[model samples]
Target: MSITPRAAEPVDIDKYGPYGRPPSKPPAEARKQTRPGPAFPNRIGTSEYPAEPGRYHLYAGHPCPFSQRVMIVRALKGLEEVLSVSILDPMRDSRGWALREGEGHGLDEVNGFAFLSEAYRASGFEGHYSTPVFWDRTANRIASNDFQHLDTDVATAFDAWATREIDLYPENLRGEIDELNEFLYEKVHNGPYKCGFAPTQEFYDTEVRSLFAALDELDARLADRRYLFGDRITLSDIRLWVTLVRFDAVYVTHFKANLRRIADYPNLWPYARDLYQIDAFRDTTNFDHIKRHYFGTHTWINPSRIVPVGPDLDWEAPHGRETK
Candidate 1:
């Protein structure tokens, strides 16, 4: 469980910083240009990357919502002992997400790569380095960084090895889950980024409005049910909870997603707390990483790089959700 801390490999700080954007380019431009890493077939029965305990590992950062989603599913499905994980340091310098010497910040045990980008390069990937990487040790290369598919594959593909019987993506609910996921991705998952990284005033204005409109609709929908689909916590709930958990603490100010705090919403606030009470969701969330990453790394937005200290959250407080 312990990893020796070493200096990260040299990289072009300017080129790799700001999420792999050139200094001259706007944040929005970077968002537009950055593409998800290439996909790798990792199904349970597939020859490429089969479901085998201790054969695969997940490279993740606690601050990343995408990574958090995969981690949540891994825990919920009881794949923690089956699939290993190495968490990167929250702050990404020019060298990108590094493995600092410490207890929580773990080095790349699978490949011993100091920088995450090095792992990408070793796998013959020249694109932007992102986390939630699915590493297949038997092949000595990254299996996938396509987070959306990666999340589901980790949830369902390892059913044979999973200890828990909980199914987040059931066959009967696929249609409903997919529909809700698509809408949430555009409006909630990626909505805050669109607001924070807007290239112009016009763009920010448009995105913030759209983001709030979607939030309003979601809040109304949750007014009756305990979760998105019904009483059970599905993939839709996991996808949306990651965003909501960070909304008041980071997105409200840093991302300018301030139409209203998630706390302001009647149903959404309690719903978030209800999910937070679950160990799979709460334990994966690292507010320290979340706050530091946004405020420290995004110097273009927060030039002073000063992380705020207020906005205290009581996620463990009674949600009163059972009354509904």
Candidate 2:
């Protein structure tokens, strides 16, 4: 059956005007003319895109954990000068994530594009817009939005140009790292979303249990090691850190993954603090963006949209992990 494209609806100008709401959807004519492009190769040495400094740009938002993961890797690998970044406003509407003018949240300086979706459309993607978008400036197209692969590619693809000598994905530990990362991704990393968005009580109950069980296992694992894989941090640590850092503040209440607050976990709490003390992890985290995006935008979960004001955090306090 052929489906006709519906005309765009009139957006509420007062509530979602130029500054407040996302920019209006692009015209139908423009969308139809969007030329499809090839997906960026998994690695950078392909004929399409090469590993060159100052040639790639990352489009990310602070509130998104997926985006946070990529940003954390970028900072850790010292790719600031090698690759550029543009941050979108924390709040998003139906029009999708916006880079408003003069909001001081950083502009879409790469393509001067208004909405993140526009960048996706330009790259021939017609699906839901997502963050941690890897754009190739030289190719004038998006490289990848598959954040799982995107994170590792950003870490390994530019190793020659990376300013830091940290080996996040070491050759010897690849087997262990991949195994643990897959486990964390299913149970802990995406567990809160499953609980929050579940349409049935039975589903929620099942997921919440799985979530806490994974947390308990992680707490036990961290009891001995400072980092996930012994002393040095790895991709697994970065994957888990993004979810843990946001747990007490947003996931506990908003997502109702409230089996217990992350702060209540003995090992997990201190471990989170230890990661936060790192300049890369701490600098990339924006509490304001994290809180507002979850509490304000998820109107289905928070109808009143009244952002909570408690749960004071002390990430700066001594983690005491050095003694362990």
Candidate 1 versus the native: TM-score? 0.90
TM-score of each: 0.90, 0.87
> Scored by CA lDDT, what does every candidate get?
0.82, 0.79
User: Which numbered prediction scores highest in TM-score against the true structure?
Assistant: 1
Worst 10 residues of 1 by lDDT: 33-42
32-115, model 1: which lDDT tens digit per residue?
Answer: 533444545345336667778888878899998989999999999888998898898887766787876554566666667787
Error of 2 at 270 (Å): 0.6
**Candidate 2 residue lDDT tens string, 134-247:** 788887888777766677777788899899888989999999999999998878877887777665677678889989999999999999989998999999999999999999
* Clash total of candidate 2: 0
